[model samples]
Structure formats: structure tokens, C-alpha cells
Target: MDHIIEAIASALNISVKQIKNTLGLLEEGNTVPFIARYRKEVTGGLDEEQIRVIQENYAYQVNLEKRKEDVLRLIEQQGKLTDEIKADVMKAEKLSQVEDIYRPYQQKRKTRATDAIAKGLKPLAEWILTLPRTADIEAEAKKYINDKVETMEDALQGAKDIIAEMASDDAQVRSRIRNSMEKYGHLVTKAKKKHTDEKKVYKMYYEYSERVSSLANHRIMAIDRGEKEKVLNVSIDFDEEYIINWTINKFTKKRTSPVNYLIDEAVKDGLKRLAFPSVEREIRNELSEKAHEASIEVFSMNLERLLLQPPMKNKMVLGFDPAFRTGCKLAVIDHTGKMIDVSVIYPHQPNAKVKESQRIMLDLLKKYPIDIIAIGNGTASRESEAFVAKLIKDYNLNVSYTIVSEAGASVYSASKLAREEFPDLHVEQRSAISIARRIQDPLSELIKIDPQSIGVGQYQHDLPQARLKERLDFVVSKAVNRVGVNVNMASAELLKNISGLNASCAKNIVAYREEHGEIHNRKELKKVPKIGAKAFEQAAGFLRIEDGDEMLDRTSIHPESYDLAKKILKELDIKEEEMGSASAADKVKEASVKKLCETLEADSYTVKDILDSIAAPLRDYRDQYAQPMLRSDVLELSDLHIGQQLEGVVRNVVDFGAFVDIGLHEDGLVHISKMSKQRVSHPSELVAVGDIVKVWVYNIDEEKQKVQLSFLQP
Candidate 1:
């Protein structure tokens, strides 16, 4: 455990004391945000993401420690414990290594060894391992040669098979074989060319293969997909003599035994029949797990970024679910996002006139004066974008429209949340409304939808579900806490994600609000049942009050931290009651921030922490993504040539290249060479997930909708 803790501390470059303090705060019911923001004295001001990594790695280390103890116990029970073996067991860092060391001792069903022993071939096998010049192999084999062992040939054959099995099962052999394969195995994929006539799904992958050791995460995923489709037959194979020679050379250099020749033959046989198969399975499984981890990690990060996108500030929004067959489902929401009305417009219906749908939208536009239009990017979305784009231009409507990434709009529409929100409305209406609502408040709206359906992941569904859920949930929870919520207005769903606020507590808050009215002051919160000292300490500072009757009510200062805020203002000789207004606000807050840190006996980062906690700006939410760049003109699809110039946002950065969104349906890939003026090991060195810059469109495949953009100027 100490070793693991030291490893984590080394990786993060933080003190063990800080790690311990952070863990204690986490265990005592404070959230990453709470600790980072208010309890910075304890955590040394580690952000939520850093804290999550710490928490996850800390848990892994604890589990590894338990596994180490268990392995040690198992080896002792098997009478194989030695100082060297104990040292190896203690040094096993990963689960796989620990399991590998314990593998030989693990109980298994009867194999060739058991069958050979059953046939009385154990004595002959022992003789081979202790070969003496006086003993003849054939003479020793004759005694055990019978029906059970068959002929003298069967006796020797059985002995050979048992020896091979024993050699393969040896921990040292398995470890050597596993390591060699990881370094050298090539994943050879061949077509069941004859099975081509069967017309299975993997036809595309049948023609290609590569080294398993070097396969990239995305490529391995694609190959796995191809295999699943039955279009490819893939096999991972490697040269066994290479691995056998390496292992035998490393292990046998210590001894010059009388049975060395027999042992060599036995090892050769073991490499072919036993070691190769076991190692192949182990390597493939390891590669798959590595690929899964990479995919899940990227998915988890993207999900968090997408979920935390800034919400459209208090405004009534009209969401349009565009579809050709059913026309468009329109949902008009009030300032609080309550559905005011819903209707349908036959904008694309064959029998209907364009003018009729045009008039329908204009009427709603006038009625609502909607602050934003959320159009689902599915089905007739492009047409709808053109429709709305032209509508705003021709009529010069003040309402602006955003093309919402409505990946799970339909799924959420079909969910119970949709039913509860619009029970009387049709499924299409619910779906369209969800699309708009999601654009307005992505975190609140998307939480009702499964993250997988939101579609930013590489192989979300294929990932280990438990791992995937854990990762996605952590991201979501972190994002929710970072955004901070209006306890008075936030939905129960959103509130439930707050630190220390469970489903029951969230429901109680909502019910309490309903029974009374808008919570006028932070003090009013103390009256809520079960929201006692601990829960309040955990949740109060995170829940904001838009215009609470009390001035501190609107700030993120916890009720417990309030006295220090007053003391700071008093030190400056300012009255606390008058400090809430515009004239004294900044001075009082700055003083308060410093005073809070001083009170807590923390650092300058802690003072800045208190500032962000008290009043985070709207930019805090949207800053996670590439900032919006509204173009004055549109690039017509027909105007595009192979080489075009445009401005783009860095949607995603990776080791290979940067994906740039240039106001198009699909983002363009700018290979690493074209990324910057200098060399870099990763795309993130120059470009982040969201950075807007000029790009040159190098290629266009309209059929595939792949736009190639380069950051390099012409």
C-alpha cells in the first residue's frame, strides 16, 4: 500500500500528506468541488479532474494491495513460498502480473498431467527430468506400458504431453512467453476467401493484417467490428522459437543440468502446444482491454465536455424536430423551460406549400420572440438550418438559431422523462422539444438520455459496461458540480448530481420549494428537513441563489464560511449590511476572498478558489469547448473546391492530428504536420479540444462528407 501511494504521489508530483488530506475530505462527505473551492486548505486546491484521478488511482492501489496479500497467502498455502517468490509477489504492480505469478498455484480441472498420472506415467516422466548416463529411457518406459498407458509408444507420448503441460503452466514460462508475445506478436488477418460466397459481415477486414503490438486503438476497434460482422477472420500468431530461445537463454544460464537436453525438447514441445496458446489468449485479451480503456477514456472526456456546454441564459426557446415525412414538431418553451405549447408544421410535406410552413414559423416567432431556436441535427436538419437561416435573414428576425447536436433526441423523447414532460403530446413533439431543451440546457436535458446515445464515443457500447458507467458518471458528476446550480430553479434531476445531495435530498428540496415558494434567502434552507449540518455543509455553497433576498444568499459562500466573510469586511472598516450593493461589492468580495483564505490559513490559490466559488461567470461553462465563431457569410457547398480557405474550431486534438469543425456537418482532420510552426509530440501541444483558428480545406469527398482542413496557411 505504501509503495502504491508513493507511486501515485510520484506520478502526480504531490506530497503524501496532501493526498491523505484530500482522501480524508472525500471520505468525510465533501465533494471535489467543495474541497477545491471551500476546503482548499486541505486539498492544496486540486481541481475536480485531478481529484478524480487521485480517487480512482487511490482505489486501484488499495485493491492491488489486497490482491498482493491474497497472492502471498495462496503461495504459502501451496508450500511454494520463498523469500524470492515473496519478493516477486510483492513487486507485482498490476492485476495481470499478480495473477500470472499466482497462476501455477491456482486450482484447475484435470489436464494432460492428471491423465498421465492416472495412466502410471509419472515415474517415467520423473526419470526423463533426472536423466542419468546409467538409465535408458526405453528401459524405464517398459514398466508403465499397458492398456491404460497403451503401448510403450503411448507411455512415452503420455509422459511427453504431461511434461509439456507442466512446463507451460510454470509461472516463469508463462511470464516469459507473455512478455515476448506482447513485444513481438503480429496480428495476421486472412480472408476465409472461400467463405466469401457465404456473404458474412467481415468481408472488408479479410484482406488486411498488422502487428498486434503496434495496432492503434481506433484501428483495433475497427478490426474488432469487422470480425464481429463476419467479414474477416483474424488470428494473432508469432514465432515461438524466438520466445522459447529468449526464455530458455534467460532462465537456463544459471544451471547445466544432466537432463538439459530432455528439458530443451520438452520446452520446444511446450512452446508449440501449450505456451503459445496460453500466451496468445493472454496477449489478445490484454490488447483488447488496452483498446477498451483508450476508447472509454476519450468517450468519457468528450461526454463531459459535451454535457457541460453553456446553457442559453433565461429565455423562452422554441425547439424544432425536423423530419421530412412528419414535417417538423415545434415545442415552444417558457422562460423557465416549461412547455407552453406544441404544434406541427408541414414544411416538407409533398402536398403542403412552403409558404404555409413559412407563415406557421413566422407566427410562432412573433408570438414568442424566442431568444434561441434549437433545431435538431437529424433527418431534415440541414434543410431546416437553411430554412431558419434564410428565415432570420429575409425577415431580419432577432431570434438566432443553433444547430443542436441532437444525437439522443429521439431516445430521450421515447424515455419516461419525455412522457412526464409532455404526456399529452405525441412522441415526435416530445422529441423535438427535447432537442431544443437540450440546446438550452445540455447538462439538465442530456442527463435524462443515456450518454452512449449522445454519440461522441469511439466504441462506447463495446466497452466494459461497468467501467464505462463508472467513467461517464464521474464526468457527469464533476461537470454538474462545476457548473453550480440555482437550488430554487434547478430540476430534481440536476440537483441530485450535486455533492452530498442524493435523490431523496434533491426530492426533499424540490418538495420544500413547492410547499413554500422561491427560497428568498440562504437561511431559509436551514428549515428543510434532513438538510442538517453535514448535508448543508456539503451542498449549500454549491447551490446558488439568482437574486436571494439576502446578498450573501446569491454568493457561493457557505453558511459556515459566512462569519469569516463578515470579519474580512470589518477589517477594512466596512459594514457588512452595506457591502451587498454595487459600490462596495468588489472590494468587499476581494477582501472576503483573502480573508476566507487567511481564516482557513491557506494560500493565494485558495483565495482565488473562493472567488470562483462565490460568483463564477457564464464563460465558465462554455469555456470547456471551442468558442463560437459566427460567420457573416456562408460557404455554399457548390463553391467548395479541393483547396478552400476557412476558419475552424479545433473540435478534438489527438496524437495523430486535430479535428477542426469549419461550420460544416463533419469536422476536418488536419494531420500533425500541418498543425503548427514547430515540432510537437501531441496535437494538444498546439491545439486543445476547442480552439478556433484559420484553416485551409485541402480536400473534399462530398459523398463521404469528409472535409480535410489544414492549420498551415497557403
Candidate 2:
């Protein structure tokens, strides 16, 4: 435990006390958001991201410890566990290192080495390994010759096999080889003759070789996928002769030994036959694991940015799910995201009833006072967008339309949860509603579907599903809790992501709300089944109640802090009902956090958060980017020209670059090289998902429908 704590502290560059305190809070059932937001003093002001890192590292360290114990026990059972070996195992930092240390003592399958040992040639192998200068190797081998060995040559071969196994199993030897390979190896890949990719997705990698130390993570995943699909064969190449010599030096004490040639042969055999295959796998797996982690981090960041996109609040949105064979699905949602109407219009193919469809769309727009049109970016989207843009311009309609990613809307529409939510509506109607709600409040609507299906990240399906889900879920939970939910307005799905509330507790809250009407105060939350004191303690701060019994209930002030808040307000001569108003906010902002802490006998961190909360009651963390890019115009691939500047929303950020949506159904790629005149390591340095940026068209592949964009000015 102490070792784990110290290692975590060093890795995170945080103090041991902070790590210990944060771990303690986590063990005591406090959620990451709860610990970060409320236990600021306890964790020495660690933020949610830091807390999450600490938690993840803590779990890894615990697993490493368990593995260490297992390795020790297994090695002890073999009766080869010396104090030195035990110390080495104990000092091993990673699980891989532990396994490397344990490999020699581990049980093995039937092999030439085991067979040689069984033939009573173990003593000969040991004597040869000593590399005696004047040893008569053939005479020693002759003594071991028997029915199983057959002759002196056979005995020598058996001894060499045993020596090869011994060299391969040495933990130090394997570690050195792995490190050398990782530092100097080149990842070589070649396409198969019969398995050509017509789309040329993997064309660049068809004949490629890059240093293992220098390959980008995205390239690794790309190469991995190509290898997996059998389009390419990949291998790591390095200096095998150098590695063989290094292994030989471990056993050869005398350079002029008569048996040195035979020992060298055995070492060479070990390098080629046993060590390289196993070590290459270890190096590649390590590289792939690192790549997976880096990719997951990228995915998690993108998902976080995507989820936290500001809601288009107080707008009557018309969700238009475009299609060709079937009529386009349309659903009208009010300011609060309630579905008020549902209809379909056949504007695109088969029907071609443009006049009739135009009339229906215009009527719906006028009927609902629709503020925005959220067109789904899917099949027939461009056509639908063109139709909407022309409709707005031709008639000079007040509403504007933006292309909303409809990646998971259809999936959500067909889900069992959707069935339960909208039992009366068809799947298309549900989809329309989902698109509308997503624009209104992305986090709320997005939490309903599987996050992996949201399509915000690269290679999400290739990632370990459990780890990906866990990380994406954490992103959702943090986003939900960061922007406090209105208890009366939030769905069970959104509520389930609240800090201490699980699916059952969230359902109970909603069920209780349904039976008893709008929850009037935080106190009423305790009445919900399965929501006990601890749950309320962890959750109350993040659940808002507008026009509730107490004014602070609508703010992020937790229930337990009500007394301190009341005392502070009383001391400041501010009325409870006027807590969040402009005058009260000004007064609270003017008050000294340190002075208040001293007067109220509270932690300084808590006092600061309370003061900030009082200044901006029910403050939305998403207000930083409160508006998404709404377009009254649309573009086509043919309309694009080199150096034509356009404003776009960054859709997805990958290692190489970001994909920006410029009102076209297909987004353009802004490669890292063209992002700026200066060199950039990754696109994330300049853009994140949902960032609105100005990009110029650099080039176009009209036939392939690919647009290369640049963030640099013309």
C-alpha cells in the first residue's frame, strides 16, 4: 500500500497525502465528482480529472500488487524463490516485469528443453553454460549418451537445447532484449498480393516501415487493423546479432573458453527460437497497449467536449430526419424538449412532391414559431439541407437550420428504452424527437444511447469495450454532474448519471415525482425509495429544484452546507430569497472568502466554492460555449474552391487532425500540417470537438468527394 501510494504520488506529481486522502474518499463511497467538487480541502484542491487519474492509477497499483503476490507464490512453489529473486519481484513496477521475473520458474509445456532435462542431460548443459576454457565438450557429452540421447552428437544437441531455454528464461536477459527492441526496432508492414483494398484506405500502409519508437498511435491502430483483416503482414525488425552477443555475454565469463563456440551457438538458437518471438510479442503488445490508452484518452476527451456542448435553450426546434425512399421524418419539440407534433414530408426522391412538402414544412414552421431546424446528417441529408436552405431563402422564413450529427439517433429510436419512453410513437417519430432533444440539450438526449454509438471518436469499436464504456460513462457522469440537473425536468437516463444516483435510484426519484408531483425541495429527495442519507449527501448539490422551498436548493450548495451558507448570508445581511439575484451576487462576490471562512469556521476551499456558487447560482459550466454553430446556409462539394474560407464546427479530433463540419454532409479534413504555419504535435492543441473555427479550402478530390481544409489564412 505504501509503495503504491508513493508511486502514484511520483507519477501524478501530487503529494502522497493528497493521493491517500483522495483514495480514502473514493473508498468511502464518494464519487469522483463529489470528491472533486466538495472534498476540495481533503484532496488538496485536486480537480475531477486529477481525481479520476488517481483512482485509475490506484486500481492499477492494486492489481499490480495482487499479481506480485501471485508471482511470489508460484515461484515459491517451484522452490526457486531466493531472497534476491523475491526482492527483484517485489521491486517490479509493471505486471509485465513481474511476469518476466517469474517466467523461468513458471510451468512449461512439453518442449525440447524439458525433454533434454528428462534424458538426464541437465548436468552437461550446466557444465557447458560455465564456458570452461579447457573443458572436453565431446567427452562430457559422451557420458550423457544413452538410449534416449543415441550418440555424442545427440547429447550435445540436447545440452544446447537446455542452455537455450535457460538463456531465454532469464528475466534480466528478456528485459534487456525487450528494451533494445523497443528502442531500435522498426515496424514493417506489407500488403498481401491477393488482398488489395480497392478503397485504398490502407494504401499508405501497403508498403510501410517506421521506427517503433517514433510511430504515431493512429498509425499503429491503422496498421493493427490492416494486419487483423489479413490485408497486411506486420513484424518488428532489429539487430539480432547484437542481441545474440548480449545474451552470450550473460553466461560466458571466459572469452577464450574452448566451449565458447558451442555456448555462442546455444545463445544464438535461444535468440532465434525462443526469445525473439516472445519478446517481439511483448514489445508489440506493450506498444499496442500504450496506443490503446492514448486513443482512449483522446476518445474520452472528445466525448467530454461533445457532451458538454451548450444546449440551444428556449428554442422550439424542428427535428428533420432526412431520407429518400421514405419521407423525411419531422418532429416539433418545444423549448423544454417535449414533443408537440410529429409528421413526415416527401421532398426528396420517389415522391418528388416538392410543392406539397414545401407547404407542409412551411405550415409546421409557422404553426410552432419554430426558432431552429436541426437537420439530421445522414442519408439524403444534403438534399434535405438544400431543400431547407432554399425554403428559408425563397420564403424568407424566420427559422435557420443546422446539421446535427444523427449518428446514434436511429439506434436510440429503436432501443427498448426508447420504446418505453415513447410507446405511442413509431421509430422514425422517436428519432425525430431524439434529434430535436439532442440540439436542445445534448447531454440529456445523448445519455439515452450507448456512448460508443455517438460516433465522436476514432476506432471506438476496436477499443476494449469494457474499458471504453467505463471511460465514456465517466465522461457522461462528470458532464451531467458538472451541469446540475433539474430534478423535476430531467429524465431517468440523465438523472442516473448524477453523482450518487444509479439507475434504480434515478428511477425511484422519477417514479416518486410522478406519484407525488414536482419535488418542491432537496428534502423531498430523501422520500424517494433507495435514496438514503449518503445518496442524498453525495447528490443533493448537483440536483436543482427551481422555485423550490429554499432558494439555495436551486444552487449547487449541498444540503449539509445549508447551515454554513445560511450563516454567511445572514452575516452579509442578504435575504435567503434574494440569494441568486444580481444584488446578492454582487455582495457575495465582494465578500472575502478568507474572512468568511474564518468567521464561519469552514474550510477555505469550501468557502471559496460557496462564494462562487452564491455569485452565480445555478451557473452552467457549459456557458463557456453556450451556442453551437447554426447555419442558415448550406454548401456542396462542387461549390467548394481552393482558398474559399468557411466557418465550421470541429466534429472529431484525432491524432493527425480534426474533422470540421462546414455545412456539408461530409466533413472536411484539416490535417495537422495545414493547421498553422508552426509545427503542431496534435490537432487537439488548436481544436476540440464542438469548437467553432474558420478554415479555408486547401484542395479537393472531387471524384472521391474529399475536401482538404486548412486553418491557415489565405
Q: For every model shown, what is its TM-score relative to the native structure?
A: 0.90, 0.97
Global local distance difference test of model 1: 0.73
For TM-score, the strongest prediction is: 2
Error of 1 at 55 (Å): 2.3
Number of colliding residue pairs in model 1: 7
Q: What is the C-alpha RMSD of each candidate to the true structure, in Å?
A: 3.5, 1.7
Q: List the pairs of residues colliding in candidate 1.
A: 201-229, 201-231, 202-229, 202-230, 202-231, 202-232, 203-231
User: Which lDDT values do the candidates have, in the order given?
Assistant: 0.73, 0.89
Q: Which tens-of-lDDT digit does each residue in 1-714 have in candidate 1?
A: 567768998989998877888888888877776777677667777888778888989998899889989989988988989998889888777888888777777786787767887888877877776545455666677888776866777888777766777777777777777766667767877765455336444555666767767787767776676666555677776677777776555434535665556567667787787778777877777778888988787777667767766666577888988888768889999766788878788767564557888898999988876888777767877677777777788888887776667788888888887787678888998887787777567788888777777777666667799888878877777888777788898888888888878888888889999999888877777788778877787888778876777666566666776665555555555554554445454654556555556665645664554344333322255555653343323345566776677877665555467787665656679988877788866565676543577888777778777877777776
Candidate 2 lDDT (Cα, 0 to 1): 0.89
lDDT of 2 by residue, 542-596 (tens): 9999888888888888888889988888888888877678998889868987888
